[model samples]
Every structure is written in C-alpha cells, then in structure tokens.
Target: MSESKNIEVSGSVMDGMAEKGGVLESPTKKPPTEYTVYPIRWLVLFIFVLYSASNSMQWIQYSIIQDAVVKYYGVSSITVYWTSMIYMITYIPLIFPASWLLDKTGLRVTTIIGSFGTCAGAWLKVFSVPQDMFWLGFAGQTVVAISQVFILNVPPRLAAVWFGADQVSSACSIGVFGNQLGVALGFLLPPMLVRAQGTVDEIAADFRLMFYLVAGFTSVLFVFILLFFKAAPPSSPSAAADLGSSLDSNFLQSIKKLLTNRNYILLLISYGLNVGVFYALSTLLNQVVLTYYPGANEDAGRIGLVIVVAGMAGSVLCGLVLDKTHRFKETTLAVYVASVVGMLIFTFTLDCGVIGVVYLSSIILGFFMTGYLPVGFEFASEVTYPEPEGTTSGILNAVVQVFGIVLTLTYERMLESVGDRWSNVGLCILLAVGAAITAAIQPDLRRQAAQHKG
Candidate 1:
C-alpha cells in the first residue's frame, strides 16, 4: 500500500504514529494509559440503529408504493421516484459539510441536528399528505435527506470512539445493519399500510396514518438521543482509539488527496457503479414488477423486501467472513462479480412470468448487491489505512449517490424507451465492468499490516 496521507478527522491528533505494538504513542513515548469500553456503548449503538433506520425508511417510503403515491399525490410515477431521488441529490452536497460539523461539534451537536431533522421531516410529511401539497412533502423529505448526511458517516466515528480495534469492523457492520433494516421496513411497511385500490380520500387517509406512525416512531428516537447519547466516553475504549484525529487535513484537501489515489479512484468507480445500480434497481423495482405482473403492487413491495432482507443477511455473513479471513480484495471481487451474475439471473427471470423465480433471483441479487457495502468500506479503509475513515467513507458514499442519480436516470430512461428486460441488462453490463475493475486493483491491506506488526 502507498504511504497513508497524514490527514486528520474530527480533529484527531496527527503527532503520534503507530508503533510496533500497533498502539499510537506520543513522541515522548509515555507509558500506555488505560482504555475502557463502556457498557453505554450498546445503548448508544442501539439508538443510532433505530435512528438510522427511521431516516432511511423515508428514503424509499414512497417509491415502494409507487402506484398509490402517484395517485394520492396526483403526480406522475417519475415524480414519485423523484421523492426518493431527492435523497441522492441532498446527500451529494451535504456529506462533507456534515462530516465537518461532526468533527467540529462532537457527537451531541451532530446527533441533535440529525435527530431533529429526522423527526421534523417525518412529521412535516404529515402536513403534505393532502393531494395539492406534494411540494411540501418534497421539502420535508429534503430535510430528512440532509439529516442522512449526518448519519451515514457516523458508524466509523462511533466505532473508533467506542469499540476496541478488534471489533471495529463488526461495530461498523451492526451500525450499517440499522440502515439496511430501515430500508427493509421502507419496502415492507408502506405497502402494507397504504392502499393502492382506494378512492383518493381513502388513499390520503392511509398516507396520513403511515406518516403519523413514522413520525411518532421518529419522535421517540429523537428523545432517546437527547437522554442518552454522549459526545464520547469518559475514557477511550482502546489504545488505538485513544490516538484520534486532530484539526488537521482541510476537508477539501482530503477530498483532493483521495481523488488522486489510483487505487482509491478505482474503488470509487467500482463501488459507485455497484451501489448506483442497486439504488436504481431498488427505486424502480416496483415498476418493473408491475409491468409484468400488473396490479401486484403488494407483491412488488414483498419482492423488494426480500431483496433487502436477503441483503441484510448477506451483509452480516460477509462481515463474519472478512473478520475470519481478512481477504479484502478477494472477498470484494467475488461478491462484486457475483452481484452481476445475480443481476443477469434477475433480468432473465423478470420477464419469464414466474414470480417465484423472480423472488429467488431477488434473494441472489440482494445478497451480493447489498452485501458489497461493508466489503467496499473495509477495502477502502485498508488501502487508505491511516486516512480518516469518516472522510474516506463520506467521499465513497458521495460517489455512490452520484452514480445513483446517473444510473437511476439511465435505467428509468431505458425502462421507458427500451424495456425492463434490457434496462436490467444494461445494469448487468455496467456491474461486469465494475467487477473487472475490482479484479485489476492491487490489494493493499495497510491497516492489517500495522495490526500484524503489533
């Protein structure tokens, strides 16, 4: 691996370097200090999990019920998807600013901003439930989308601050699990609660009820954040955790440095394409199913739920595998390529008119497709070992959203002009390119190298 640029995040100290023991020490080489893992970390993690799930639920809340939302909002299906697209749009510009806020303000202030934004957004949507208030709903969604910027980059910071080095990856996975679970509920709950076969007033009532449920849930989590979330523990959780970021590395400089790295750039390309396609597929999945199945809106949501639920399992399994194997490049390449295969199967199966096969193929697609998330995070961290995990991850996510916008547009265009079958074929070809890129990268596990030397 190339030498890690000495960039700091959240103002971590840059003076100390990792020694042979894998513990960073001061230049004076003071004797090791005690690091304690507080039980409160679980409470912190739990609240964050729910909070993340709540915010993410809003991301796909409407899209999963595309037919119903289009009618209730008196808008086009693309307009309904735009409700979800607002998330990608907001995330791109706000991620760095959010990272900077977390760095400057510590956990409490950041949590305040994220939690309030989430709760407020959820409730604000209630006011937009009336047919003419689509713009108002969009505004509320934009608020929640902005809050995600504060939330998505938090897992690494949380893990570093609260977990031992040995457990960082697992901690990160669990945090990500919250976000995935939220997406699952986004796919599952809205379809069940909101009615597709109802009068406009009846559908509006369903939307109102669903929005209230989410808003109530979000409000409770916001209170939990106020009561429990600490900025940091009284003591660090591990020796490595103790050696933290300083007010170094200008945010723009860090972005430039990350963009300049060839390996990291390749990662951005591969990860971005994989995630972008996943996002587009998830957003438009219902339309693809409806085109074939016709009026099976509930089953459309169920298919999406299967994809996400399968993805959650795949994510957990991959985390366990990487923990045991530490095979960053090999693991990522295998999963990335498999996702393409999964997509290929799903494409051919979608038009076969066999809903059962479609379900099975979704399981395969979701498993590797969503499974690649943590793998990408881990690989990027390895190659850019000493760079701030928060910044690297933030940039990585930003790239994914960029691809999300592009591919979602392309997929929608093709789905309209070419057909659902070929639109997915397009995704398969794109992911194949990503897989080849993944294969070409030289594996660098500098973080692990430092750990082994310890």
Candidate 2:
C-alpha cells in the first residue's frame, strides 16, 4: 500500500490511467484531452470568496485598532498584539489535522468546518465585547484563527477543481482576493467604527456595534455555504486536475514528496521570509505609524486600507499575467525584490512626517508584497506537480505562519531596543536573503509541461 512513485510529466500512460472523482478514465484517453468548465464553478467560487473574507477579517481586527483595544480591555500593547499573533501560533498545530481532513473528508466538509468556526467565533465576540472581556474576545479570535487552517488552503484546490489549465492561476488569485479584501476592510473598518479618543464606555459601545455587525454577516454566510458548496464538479476541469485528488489521497506520502522536493523547499523558505514579514508589518502597522504620528489613529487605519487595496489589485494582475505567461520563477523573483525596495522606502518615509508620502509608500509595498501570495501558491503547485493542491498549499501556509510569529517577535524587540530605523532595516535584510534564495531556484515547471502534453 506504500509507494513513492516518480511521475513523468509527459502525459505518460500512468497520467492517462489516473482516477477522477473515484471513477477510472477511459483507457483510450490520450494527451491533450478536452475538459469542461461549468457555470456553477462561479457560484462555488463566490461562496468561497465570502467566507474567506469573513474568516480573514479576524486576522487583523484587533491589530489595526490596537490603541482602542488596549484602552477598552485595560491590557498592554503586547497583549493587544497577541490577539492577532495567536492566529499564527494556532495555525501551526491545526494545519496538519486540517490538511488530513481536506484529503480524507474532502472540500465540502472541511469548508463547512471553517464557515462554522467563523460564525461561532464572530457571535462569541458579540457576547464578550460588550463586557470589555479581553479573554473572551481572544478566545473568539483563536477559534477564527483555527478556522483559517481550513480556509487558507482552499484556493488552490478550488481553482484546480473548477477551472481550466489556462485559468487556474487567475482563479487562485481571485480566491485569495477574498482574504485580502477582508484584510482591507479589517484595516478600514476598526478605525472608522471604534475611536481611541472615546471614554471606556464609549469605546465599549463602539466595539460592541462592530462585533454584532460582523457576527450577523458571518451567520448569513454559514447558511449560504451549507446549502451551495460542493467538493468538485461533475468532471475534472483540466487534464492535470483529473489526478489532483487521487495522487494526493495518501496524505502522509504527499507530505514526504513536498518536503523532499528541492524547489518546493526553497519556495517555502522564500515564501516564509517575504510573506511572514508582510504579516508582522501589517499587524503592527498602527504601532509603527503611531510611534511617529501620535494621535493619528484613523490615519494609520486608512494607510492599512491603502496597503491591502493596492495588494488586491496586484494579486489579480499577477494572477492574470501568470495565466498567460506561466513565468513562475521570473515573476516571483521580481515581486520579492520589489518588496524589499518598497520596504526600505516605507522605512524612510514613516519618519518623513507627511502622511501622503506614507500612503504612497504603502501602495508600492502592498502591491507586490500582497500580490506575491497568489504567485507563490501557483508556483508551489508548479514546482510540485501531481501533488494535491491542498497539501502543497497547507505546507506553504504553515511555513509563513511560523515565520510570521518569529518575525513579529523579532520586530517588536528591535522596535523597542534599537528604534524604528533599525527594526525596518532588519526586515529589509531578511527579505534580501529571501530574494537571493528565490533566485537560486531552477524550477522544472512540471505542471506547465504537462499542460502542453495534454
């Protein structure tokens, strides 16, 4: 029952013989088989977009308005940071189980688990926020964070299950766009809804309103997904996608394949560095901005919005480009290097005292940095062809979360001891190292090669 087959990507006999939706394909099937793309695929994608946003909203809900949270909850700034930090911490343990569930139980069951978690977590906060109960609020966030394990890895699988080979990259980006949209609103909503200038009672009232609204929204999403979401279409959307599930059926074996792949290992390291630093920077943006521009709490929130909104555009654009070019390595390296330049500029401009310049810096930084997410996911699928999308995506997400926790702690320490200049400079250096690693990877483009044969 145990096997580690080295698959050839040239439309070999084994490729034609792979099982799809638990049914064996015709033996007469040959290279370049025609595939179907259902209209229902769009509907499934829409449901995914909604809940992905709902779940991702919790990632930065407290971090954007850290000042208000600290005052209302009567906690330290570090305690406020942990509300967001715990998401990364919880993800490490939960991802293994979540991936197992994704492989075993399939998409519908695993997806509903995330929707239920999001709904439950949001409502739980509605109960706790009115009381200024920080522990209860954190408990709710942990539940949401746990839900992310199911949600984050869904995009790649969603794309491959429903989209054609040419459209998979763009579909993956559109899927991730939901999460970035959640983050954009997460940045925009808190400062607009809750103000740090208010009294404790006033702050609690504002926070209460925000929680009730999100809770109601997630409640609606849970019902929608319950009725509509399905695991896969009637047939595979692409030739490569036919083997997507069966090849990854042995979850443990898939892990072994991905961990041992040289290109995948490099992609994981670079992804952790670039994306992890983005996580720390976003979660702590208010802190960084507040240090120099005191009393500009709302301004900090707006800047956060600018960062993600720009990233939303970048992600869509990057995905579209990759769909056409399939230039995985070139695009990834370009984005990573641009992210470093953007970071250095942001580091200098934070002290420039002009908010407009800061906004411009955030746009440049977020566009590529956030955009790099889809590129990384698609590239992972490419480098580890024939591996299940969920397993590959899950491992990629875990690496970033680990680095997210480490880099966040490191940034906090440097911000305290050496001040803003050095803290950001340090992030830039780590990113450069990541860029060099990315440059060194000579990916085989196995998935793209298979597409040509098919």
What does candidate 2's lDDT look like per residue over 175-203, in tens digits?
99999999888888989999789987888
**lDDT of predicted model 1:** 0.83
Q: For each candidate, what TM-score against the reference?
A: 0.90, 0.92
| Collision pairs in model 2 | 32-454
**Candidate 2, residue 287: CA error in Å?**
1.1
- Alpha carbon lDDT at 299, candidate 1: 88
TM-score (C-alpha, index-matched) for candidate 2: 0.92
Q: Write the per-residue lDDT of candidate 1 for residues 273-295, one digit (tens) a residue.
A: 99999999999988889999998
Assess the local accuracy of residue 101 in candidate 2 as a C-alpha lDDT between 0 and 100.
Answer: 89
